[model samples]
Target: MSRGAGTAVGVLLILTGLVWAGQGLGLIGGSFMTGQTRWLVIGLAVASVGAALLAFVRRRGG
Candidate 1:
């Protein structure tokens, strides 16, 4: 994918991960993931990957 598209996807993933984590922790509520530790962990991992991808791309002059 193009650099811009990749960046957009990375941002989206990060935002989604934050939301998922919130929902999982019952902070956002209104979903099956509420109070689910597994989802919370998954969200954090996804957010970390997204952040790392963004950093790597930026360092490479994407």
Candidate 2:
């Protein structure tokens, strides 16, 4: 991926990390779940987004 796309992944990772940490601490709602369900749902969602971004991001011309 281009450097900019890599940077985008890095930012996404940060956002994903923060969401998980917040979920662990009960600082934010997990949209469609409660308690442990929150962790599962949010984690899966974040992972899916990351994977999709990685798959579609421009891979040449950094």
Candidate 3:
């Protein structure tokens, strides 16, 4: 994908992941994911993927 697209996806993923993580940790409530260990794991994985994408973009000199 293009650098811009990659960056955008990376940012979006990171934000989404953070929100999920918050819900999982019960920091952000209201959803079924709240305080769920599975959500927490999923969130972390998503965030890590986002971070990796960002890193790739940076390494590409974007």
Candidate 4:
């Protein structure tokens, strides 16, 4: 992927992770999803994915 595209993907992953975290923590508010722990688990996984994407962005020729 192009450098910009890779960076954007990385950023998006990080944001998604944060949102999932909020949902899990019940901090998102506004009656979004119906579960708590579920959000948390999903958030954690997304965050890991984001971190991996970031790593990918930082790798040589990425």
Taking every candidate in turn, the Cα RMSD to the unseen true structure, in Å, is 1.0, 5.1, 0.9, 1.7
All models: lDDT? 0.85, 0.62, 0.94, 0.78
The reply for model 3, stretches above 4 Å from the true place, is none
Residue 2 displacement in candidate 2 (angstroms): 1.0
Candidate 4 deviant stretches above 4 angstroms:
none
- Lowest lDDT sum, 10 consecutive residues, model 2, at 31-40
TM-score per candidate, chains pooled: 0.90, 0.47, 0.93, 0.80
lDDT (10s digit) by residue, model 4, range 1-62: 87678778878988988888887788887656535788888887888887787788778455
Q: 34, model 2: CA deviation in Å?
A: 6.2
TM-score comparison, 2 vs 3, better candidate: 3
lDDT of 3 by residue, 3-55 (tens): 99999999999999999999999999999999998899999999999999999
- Candidate 3 RMSD to the real structure: 0.9
Winning candidate number (TM-score): 3
Q: Is candidate 1 or candidate 3 better by lDDT?
A: 3
Clashing pairs in 3: none
Compute the lDDT of residue 56 as modeled in candidate 3. Answer: 99
lDDT of 1 by residue, 1-62 (tens): 66787788779889989988988888988889999998899899888888987877777775
The full ranking of all candidates by TM-score, starting with the best, is: 3, 1, 4, 2
**lDDT for residue 32 in candidate 4, whole number 0-100:** 62
lDDT string, candidate 2, 1-62, tens digits: 67676758956865785577466456677543334555756666676677656655545335
